[model samples]
Target: MSTSDPRPALFDQWLPAEYRRRGDFTVLVVLVGIDTRSIELLSSTFMNVIGDETRWREVRQLFQSSETDWNGAAFFPVDSVIGPVPNDMARTQLRALEEKVRADRRVLNGGHFFDRKGRRLKVEEIVH
Candidate 1:
């Protein structure tokens, strides 16, 4: 998506000033084709691979997750209001998890990640 994508507006439904004051940034990352169970377990899987639950947990605590049913398929709408991570650290971790999960073509086959502005970014955007 371009910088003007309106979808990014949904990224921050309610980012509290207190969070931002602490350098926390609210973000939205969308993943499709994953069951609700996998979505719930995603955090654990992520931490397992990175071995930095402290950094991950700091962001994970503010997670707000939901699922969308469209045409009988499920889409995960995951967002977090945690940040202050230096240099887009959360986005990097999220992209890593997205690619790793989809690599095996298992439960999570595909999805897209977006920045806080709702701008859709390619996996490469964050991977490199």
Candidate 2:
């Protein structure tokens, strides 16, 4: 996907093999966008991966509108959340959540998360 594409493409590196058998997983998504200088986080959400289709649709709609310029998103499985928090807190929480998921053995080697246009974004492109 191009940087100007409003529809964000999804990526995940640690999806487990038994995801389909285990059903939906809860996650905290970090939306990203690229400007002239760097890739930046645009928004965050605490939601279920499969059950929150409406919410994901809303996010895409928002991106299509004039309100946002996001082009990509990454999802991380999180155990819980205390409602909306600041972006700084969300980033910190994401790290902790990743460790938790890793410890729980919920993450595995090669699995697909979700992709909008079948474009896999490079880590260097997303991480500033």
Candidate 3:
């Protein structure tokens, strides 16, 4: 998508300060698609293939991770809030969520989550 594309717009335009407070930056990178080699070239010419390759590896590791530091873990939406999804199922569940979003805007409003304490919370914005 172009920078002008509305679906996956720039981070600052969409994410709120609350989301950036902890600063793990993995989810940010993923949402921004910064690890994609083509997007990296489009985003900046100063960064070369080495940087992109490194980031690609890092991004892959994060997705393969079962657990991460608080900041990384914090990026994960609570399952009950989103569904009965287990933490290990994050990748598959997220793909489904993305597909649902593409199929219907109502799913954006439909998704919800529950915290460890069982508090109900809606997935207000994918990044918020």
Candidate 4:
């Protein structure tokens, strides 16, 4: 593959992987200019990036129950640091992430979604 190959380059940061723990809605991690579908593709790479069958299995379970494209929320390691990212921090992280990745050239991208009503997002808004 070339420099522009669609595959996500080896991830440098071991930021926590996570999944939705409650309602049907999901939060996504993505970049502004990139296509959402392309960002969604990273779900398949989580297992490889995670590099552990047991770990992926646990993370997989979090998403499998939802009507997700595996793109609903973040993916965390099953054994440690594997759970929901606090919504406030998640939003803050995304705010500066674009610039952070550009300076560092990391393939990091995703969205932290919420509802239009200024409240936390619900399942309907997330899955549909």
Provide the overall lDDT of each model, using Cα atoms, as 2-decimal numbers: 0.33, 0.46, 0.29, 0.32
lDDT of 2 by residue, 54-112 (tens): 44455456445745566755565544344335556656876664555345322311122
Checking candidate 3 for backbone clashes, the offending pairs are 80-114, 81-112, 81-113, 81-114, 82-112, 82-113
Q: What is candidate 3's lDDT per residue for 1-128, written digit by digit as tens?
A: 22553322222222233233322222211121222121111110011111112322343354446242211111233223332344345555555655554454334323222222222222332442
Candidate 3 shows a clash count of 6
- Tens digit of lDDT per residue, candidate 1, span 94-119? 66655665564333323334232333
Q: Candidate 1, which ten residues in sequence have the lowest lDDT sum?
A: 44-53
lDDT, candidate 2, equals 0.46
Query: What clash pairs does model 2 have?
Result: none
Residue 57, model 3: lDDT of 36
Instruction: Please estimate how well model 1 matches the true structure, expressed as its whole-model Cα lDDT.
Output: 0.33
- The superposed Cα distance between candidate 2 and the true structure at residue 21, in angstroms, equals 5.0
Candidate 1, 63: how far from true, in Å? 17
49 in model 2: Cα distance from truth in Å?
A: 3.1
Scored by TM-score, the top model is 2
Which stretches of model 2 miss by more than 4 angstroms?
1-21, 50-59, 62-66, 79-118, 125-128
lDDT tens digits by residue: candidate 4, 1-128: 24653423322112222222231222334312223322322222122222222333444364555444433333222222534355555555444553454554223322222111112211221244
C-alpha RMSD of candidate 3: 15.5
Give the TM-score comparing model 4 with the true structure, all chains together. Answer: 0.27
